[model samples]
Target: MSTQKRTVLITGCSDGGLGAALARAFKDAGFFVYATARNPAKMQSLAALDIETLQLDVQSQESVNSCAARIKQLDVLVNNAGGQFVMPLSDVDIEAAKKIYDLNVWSQIRVIQAFLPLLIASKGMIVNNTSIASVAAVPFQSIYNSSKAAIASVSETLRLEVEPFGVKVIDLRTGVVKSNLINNLKETQHPKLPDGSIYEFAKDTVEKALRQDGFEGQGLDQAVWAKAIVGDLMKKNPPALIWRGESAWLSRIASILPHGLLDGTLKKLVGLDIVEKAIKEGRH
Candidate 1:
């Protein structure tokens, strides 16, 4: 218990992503950071800095328990390691959907459940990296959107429940962060795509959506978000939800929009109408 240094653990940190940036930010702020990923070797960059990298896969109970057992003290817990896959509901594969949920939703739950005791002991803060898609259902990404939505719900409840213990739970609504998630999309055949079906037109559109992350030129700066996150965590009592990036406001607006209007808008924005047109043209 060094009074001068804080300890923070973050999940899903590899290289060139929000997690990595957060790791650097915490280290710069004079905190001991545990940068955890499924493959500890992926976080080699942290070696040059004053950060410890650990192996943690949220989906595996053993991995979560092992990591939790090793953590004796922690000031902050950042659940930043989750990913998304975009596929039409009609074309969504059950196994792929399960895997995505395993990573995005269940993993967070496992981590929080496992590490909650330590958080309570330190009276620390929990930052759950939710997304703009949590509230707004984007075309071709129903599952990812749902998972984040679930996180937002859990964060809200956890914040209240842990308040009595002096622990803060923050729901971070992030928009368009530069990350390697695009490069790691699972490449498998869609179960809903038969020899000829409506989903055939969606293959290209879905690919683009799955690979597309962050704004083209004005995405959220990972360093900026990281610094802000650490600063907020240092506050005596930080806000419950922190919206990061330019599109954060847009997501708020979308969340309040009428269902019909929102669906129409998303369909146009994500090119679902184009896919429908292609299907009509017998492109499958």
Candidate 2:
């Protein structure tokens, strides 16, 4: 065992988020962790834990460049800075949806491009944080699902593109782990009022589906989830795809089901079956 530690740079590591959890887990595993956030102050506790912290807004090229410039030996790069868009596509504000893609999709490209030199030198790996939504688009979160689906595509193309350079890119299709995202997205502004759209009469049902993360015993702990991620990445022959989280198996099942069956199941689970019945009965 060498005392010299491999360095890892992770974005969106604000406290209480999975990024911060990864920072701590990697730090505990003897990796030098660079925990970054759009606002460094949000990661003050990470600094207190002796992990290096950087201020990085992945949406801004300058910010990405500055952060990349400061890293001299990045052995692993994690793209985790992203937001959620929870609404029907018809009512999804195009501008806001673009912002979601900017953060969720393009930010990964920006950071990867900026740090490619370091990764190439280290023969390192890129871990992209995508969601199971990529496999099966959720009912109202179409924008979010599509954005992750884009990353899913990018991950495959990138893995092939970077393999000859001795760099590996892994798409981590994470299932819901407990995080502040649910709380944060509650504040997300959408153009459609819940009470005045296709879901107007099914507002409660729709909202419940949005909030119900398929977790076991409360939900997966962010720390445990992060540990699993870092653990898998550290494997000698890490796969191109690493999938795990609460009810993650369910997502895998959902992904392979027949299209009609999957669609019908999702609609019924979200109370759409009831909504459809109500609509037919003059309820809406």
Best by TM-score: 2
Task: Show model 2 residue runs off by greater than 4 Å.
Answer: 1-3, 190-196, 207-218
lDDT of 1 by residue, 87-177 (tens): 6686677898888888888889899999888889888889999988897778778898999998899899988999999888999998766
- For 1-284, candidate 2 gives per-residue lDDT tens digits of 12258989999999888899999999988898889999999998799998889899999999999888777787899998898877766566688889999999999899999999989998999999988889875677789989999999999999999999999999998887888776666556523444457777777766666664442235588889988888999999999988888767788887777766677776775566787888899987
Judge candidate 2 at residue 11 and give its lDDT.
92
lDDT of 2 at 106: 94
Task: Report every candidate's CA lDDT.
Answer: 0.80, 0.84
lDDT of 2 at 30: 84
- Clash count for candidate 2 is 0
